[model samples]
Target: MRDASSGNALSDTMEVNDETQAPGASWLPRGDDWVLQLSGAWRGQRAALPELPAQDFNGAVAVDAEALRSWDAGLAAQLWQQLDPLARRSVTLDLQGLPQGLQEVLALALHDAPPTEEAAVGPAHGPLERLGERTKTWWADHRKTLTFVGEVLLSMGRWVRGKSDMRTSDLMWQIEQTGPRSLPIVSLVCFLVGLIVAYMGAAQLQRFGAQNFIADLVTVGVVREVAALLVGIVLAGRVGAAFAAQIGSMRANEEVDALTTLGVNPFDFLVLPRVLALLIVGPMLTAFGAAVGMAVGWLVAVGIYGVTPLEYVYASVESLTLPHVVVGLIKGTVYAVLVALAGCLQGMAAGRSAQAVGDATTASVVQAIVWIVVAASVLTVVFQRLDF
Candidate 1:
């Protein structure tokens, strides 16, 4: 920002070989850009420059044909040839994307001549400033649409803390609605998952004389990954879709509006109980699924390896640590929040149309599953780094 030298123009006193030289070896003005001359110099130099002025780019692009009458076509190319990418980067920044004020300045300059060095800064601010301000206001207005989230969670805490008029019946109803109703599918899928994983582990470890470790392998792998994932998939389709559908149905019927008319908070009465219920049931179902998976795996292990049931159980238990179990529970809890939040948010935001309700339900399942997988993978990486 300060002056490069307090004195005069620079002088290249050293006599370097002229033939071994760069094409456009001219010094830029101290802070200015792309204002090069054909005569190369510091001060005392015979420079053969290839650079062009910053202000003449568009003028060069589709210029007046009459302006070229004084010179041949070869002269125009020699005078204003296409720049290399690096030079184009610098040159276009000053010329091609000219602001309105800069465009006016440039137009006026064409009527007269190239701008004097002092007039190079043609405009102060560009159009992006107003665009930025509008973007800020747009974000602020949309943020209010999501204010119901915090209130929903607060109402959940109240229900958890107190035993009164706090939707305990609804909580049980939801557990019945989501977890109990999903038992058949959950059981079947977990069983298949267990069978598949156990078969794979056994086949590989058997080749290495580590067949007995199959129980341990199945135990750790199920608890850490498959169990939590099974619970999450069920929650995404079962509990999540249900939340979206219920709230969306209420929205369609204007029951949520009726609650506001009666001075009963919609978030507390509707979303709170559902969210709290899912959080409570998610960890329980995950543990239940993990137990079932391990049971199925043990059956296969005992039957195939001729290992005793007692030995398989002992080996599986011995192979696992408290940390692995804790990690699975933690993952389940995280998935519960994401699934419930996604479903409730989509449902509450859902349009009044029946199709909108279905859309919300579908979106909730997809988003919950995606976010759950991402969170689980990140947690897995973090846990591996922890080396526990």
Candidate 2:
């Protein structure tokens, strides 16, 4: 072989021509120079480069990409892997035949030539530093939650003015989900709690020959606190998790982004319906739970404790005021709003991954329950001060 332009005879030339081979680069020894020939369509995952030989070649390397029909980032990556090692060994590289774009990409890829070194590991933060970091994170989260709540309130205002984009059918469906479908669990848990309260109260009252007062204990407790609290906790785990998982999955799939692209407000279309539905249904569920709870108390008082049914009913009714019922319903409504907000916030902030959806669902349930408990405590204190 000979160089046509230089008219120089080329001896000891090594030719690597394999037509059936996959897209790759091959190095051939020719005197003091090594010709790195890249062939076939070097595109995407299909571009395969062979492993470099273990033996060191102390010579110049010339890249020959004239046989390349097409190329992409994969081709650049393959070339970089080969060229990086050669450059480490101080071998000169001639990227003459490669496309200008590919040459630019390769140059940019390996511009920061750092000699490989062991990864440095830092010491863990002290307790005070960790606490400060946590406090900062909590404050940031609180601000985000407040902003989300404000957006939801604004969306509700839009709904009130009939300017919201949320569909009526979606709202109705949400109501149905949070309302009637929740009755069975609420009834069961409230009834059990009422029975437990009655039994415990009766045991103490019987010792003092004041068993008749069991009705007062059961009724006041169930109506004023237990029923609403139990319902809130139940919905926090059940309905709150559902809301988070649903919206988080939508976020993971970019459906929420699609809604934004279509000029739809996610707070109006998604969050508002859920919040309103839970708010409207919370009192209804609480009332149902309270009634079932009271009925269980009545059964315990009349059947086991030997109290007359009429006397039991009279005592229970007399112990409960309109204010007690109002307070419990108010708590239920507040808890519902908190649960919806927590779930929606977690869902909206979810990362784009399957694991993120699961994390959001778990966080939503936990946050909803914590908020419910905190709100319950505050409401109790306020109601007590007002003597409700």
- Highest lDDT scorer: 2
Q: Candidate 2's error at 219, in angstroms? A: 0.8
Query: Which residue pairs clash within candidate 2?
Result: none
Which residue ranges in model 1 land beyond 4 Å of their true spot?
1-148, 157-165
For residues 18-85, write the lDDT of model 1, one tens digit per residue: 32232233324423444332221122333333444454333223121211112223322333333323
The clash numbers for all candidates, in the given order, read 1, 0
- What does candidate 2's lDDT look like per residue over 215-272, in tens digits? 8898888888999999999899889999999999999888999999999999999999
Our model 1 lands, by Cα RMSD against the true structure, at 19.4
Query: Which stretches of candidate 2 lie above 4 Å from their native place?
Result: 1-131
